[model samples]
Target: MVLLEMSIVPLGQGESVSQYVARCVEIIERSGLSYELHAMGTIVEGELGQVLDLMRQCIEEVAKSANRVTCTAKIDYRQGVTGGIRSKVASVREKLGRVAGPN
Candidate 1:
């Protein structure tokens, strides 16, 4: 799985936080990948290649607004696990015949 964390700064248009977030949400939804949009960031999780492609598309869509927007996307990725870090660790424990301890 791949997770992308992005911070977008929009310039010249004085775009509200809500507007910026809404635009990002729209782009993410249009990408057809499962995503979570937050007040200051977005999280996208999916297959590596597809997520990367969609991230690029998202950046491009934001760029098209003609508002002198600049976006920085920080991506952290893991392979072969869809349920994220905890699930990955649990799977490893299961394979090793040891149950995961309580958090």
Candidate 2:
């Protein structure tokens, strides 16, 4: 499985680009892939090819409206592993819960 974290920014679309971001989220949602949307980017988990293709679609879709677009991505791949989108976070939280400290 592949876990990809991506952020698509459409240039010259003013200070706020939530509208474009929303479109990208729409595409991700429709892809039926497990994903998590965070403040800085969205993380999607799927086959490597499908995930890359999805990112391409998002970039092209945003380019249709914006003059220029920028995409930042981080990818993790592990053979025979899956569901990292949620499991990864859960693993961290599980470890954090073991810590004897204040929140």
Candidate 3:
């Protein structure tokens, strides 16, 4: 599986971008990909092609109402690797001898 940390910004939108963010997240959820929403962005895990397609869909969807849209994505593609979203965090916490907790 591939992991993507994606942040979509709708330019020209007012100070609060909750609407656009919600819409983008709606797109993510509708795609049926596993994801985690964070303060700065969303993390999605899926196949490479699907994740890229999702990014394209996000840009296009936001562009429908947004004058300009900026998308930032951090992709982690690992062959024969899966489920890094939760496990990766757990690995680090284990190394630090700590338990999982709310962020």
Candidate 4:
């Protein structure tokens, strides 16, 4: 089960947080994938690729309804027990150390 962290930035239309989140939930449901949408402001999480794709589609649909409306998405996958991507990368770096220059 892949976990994803996403941030969606809505433009143009003055959409409330609840409204935007509701729209996102609807889109995810339509995608035929099981997901959980957390209401913690801008950031959201769920299944990896599926949720992100649905979020993009929802944003597009919303934009079509409102002039100049657009949204940007950022997604990151969770590695293991720890949630943060930075923590995961740091763990990897500690194991690998710095690479030597090619001779």
- Candidate 1 on 27-103: residue-level lDDT in tens? 77887776766666887777778777776776666677755777778777766657563565587889889989853
Candidate 1 Cα lDDT to native: 0.71
lDDT of 3 by residue, 11-103 (tens): 888778778789889999999999999899999999999999998998898899988989999999988888898889988998999999754
State the displacement of the C-alpha of residue 95, model 4, in Å, after optimal TM-score superposition. Answer: 22
Candidate 2 residues lying further than 4 Å off, grouped into runs, are: 98-103
Q: What is the lDDT of residue 65 in candidate 3?
A: 90
Clashing pairs in 3: none
**Cα lDDT of model 2 by residue, 7-53, tens digit:** 99988889898888899999999999988888999999999999999
- TM-score for each of the candidates: 0.66, 0.89, 0.93, 0.47
In model 1, pairs of residues that clash are: none
| Candidate 3 overall lDDT versus native | 0.90
- Candidates 3 and 4 compared: the better one by TM-score is 3
Give candidate 1 misplaced runs (Cα > 4 Å).
Answer: 85-103
Q: Write the per-residue lDDT of candidate 4 for residues 2-89, one digit (tens) a residue.
A: 4454434456656564566677667766666544454552343446666566666877766655655445455565545434433444
Indicate the TM-score of model 2: 0.89
lDDT preference between candidates 3 and 4, better one: 3
Candidate order by TM-score, highest to lowest? 3, 2, 1, 4
